[model samples]
Target: MKANQKATILLIYTGGTIGMIKDADTGALKAFNFKKLIKGIPELKLLDCNIETVSFEKPIDSSNMQISDWQKTAEIIEKNYTNFDGFVVLHGSDTMSYSASALSFMFENLNKPIVFTGSQLPIGDLRTDAKENLITAIQIASLQEKGKPVIQEVSLYFEYKLYRGNRTTKISAEHFNAFTSPNFPELVESGVHLNVNNEVLLKENVSKKLKVNTNFDDNVFILKLFPGINKTILHTLLHTPNLKGVVLETYGSGNAPMENWFIDEIESAIKRGIHIINVTQCSGGTVLMGAYETSTRLKEIGLISGKNITTEAAITKLMYLLGQNVANSVFKTIFETSLRGEMND
Candidate 1:
């Protein structure tokens, strides 16, 4: 990239509230034609960048987003990797965190920005926040130093903050601030001027070429523990046919019941080669297995600690790792280590 070259950005509209417009005929909400986006938001013409648009043939709501949708998004980025400087993914906010986390894992050695954003209100609304969010996300993606992109990893830009994709979780539905990064700080903040926290940004790996990994296994389940959970439920879930992994949502610091039946069921599952990950139910803390007496048995029985990882990241990472056909013996070690900064060391 030369200093004199203008940035080229790709806007991918995958059905969401942000892309909806009220139909004059039926007064119903419909997906906006992204090809005419500039006409709808003329402010885009003022930016010093070349913008291109693409849309899903049939837009899907975020709640209905599936693994195939993730693969399609990855394929889109891979297809245009060399042609575009950055990508702004307009997705529904309901499952944006999940999609963001999945994309973060799917791309390897990425050196360009893949920013996900959406709004609570439609862009056609007079008092909508969609305009600001959309414009700022593109601006953030267009930012560069020297001749390279400033953001070099998958991120989520919402309201007025930019957070690492895997670190974010949706915290609000009614408010404009719809996302939060519980275990990590934001990478950038929007205000009078865009303030980037360069210290937290992922350094670009220019030595490696970008690679996309679309393999994802959906044979994993999240087992959330609660008081009075009985043996039958535990046994039945663990005994599910062809189950590959389990994300055990334990109590604070990864603590679980110490009952004999509970220990027996968990130990039997592990012995049968089920990979169980211990993560805290708390939103803001790390899972410290063996930190207390209640968790010592779990550690001894070979539960992998999900250290400060959001549940969204944990499940997606599990699917990614499982799809890679990681060896059973080394799976625990690899999962405990951070492959894409999804968890603390």
Candidate 2:
């Protein structure tokens, strides 16, 4: 890399509020053509990077996103990984955390930045956060340290803060600040200057070749625990056909009822080869199993501890590992471990 060499960035628009505009006569929001992206954001021309854009022909809202969509996004990145210096994914904020987490697992040994961003208001709105988000996300992607990509992992940029993708969750619907990584500090922050906490940024793995994994098993479900959950209802979910994994969103610090029936239900499921992961319901804090009597049974029954992992990451990780056909003996250990900077130590 040379000073005069311009970095090439690939901008992928998968459709969301960021790609919508109000029709003048009809006044209804519709997808904007990516061909007019440069014209719409004239300031992009001033940037040092050469930009190329691709889009989904039928822009599906974030709510409609599926595993196939995640596969498609990964495919695009895989196909163009060599050509682009960095990548930016324009996605709807509603499910951005899930998408980002999924991609983090899909792209193994990623050495380039994949910044995911979207807006609460449409890009054409009078008051929009789209431009700022888009601009900074690209800048973060194009960042180079000693001629190498600075941020070398999947990340989400929203409301002037950049967070590790798998660590973030959408916490609001109406606010510009819609995403937060409650359990993790931000990788970067934008204010008077783009303040990057470089020490925490994921270091690039230059030795490993980039691998795109799209074989995700969706035979997993989230069972969020609540007070007074019926035994019958719990049994029914635990017996869902073809269920290979479960993200059990447990109470504080991964504690759950110490009742014999509850512990037996989980033990039965685990014995039947169903992976039971205990994740804390709270936004922050690690799951310290056996820290209390309520959680000791879960540990004794061999439930995997999702320590400080977001539910989005836990579920996606379950699917990824299951798709890989990990052995049952090692599944619990792998699920509890951080595969892609998705969880803390």
- What are the TM-scores, per candidate, against the unseen true structure? 0.98, 0.98
Give lDDT per model, in order: 0.94, 0.92
lDDT of 2 by residue, 179-281 (tens): 9998989999999988999888887569989888899999999999999998899999999999999999999999998888988889999999999899999
User: What ranges in model 1 sit over 4 Å off?
Assistant: none
- What does candidate 1's lDDT look like per residue over 303-329, in tens digits? 999999999999999999999999999
Q: List clashing residue pairs in candidate 1.
A: none
TM-score for candidate 1: 0.98
- Output the worst ten-in-a-row residue range by lDDT, candidate 1: 202-211
| Deviating ranges (above 4 Å) for candidate 2 | none
Candidate 1, after superposition: displacement of residue 291 in Å? 1.1
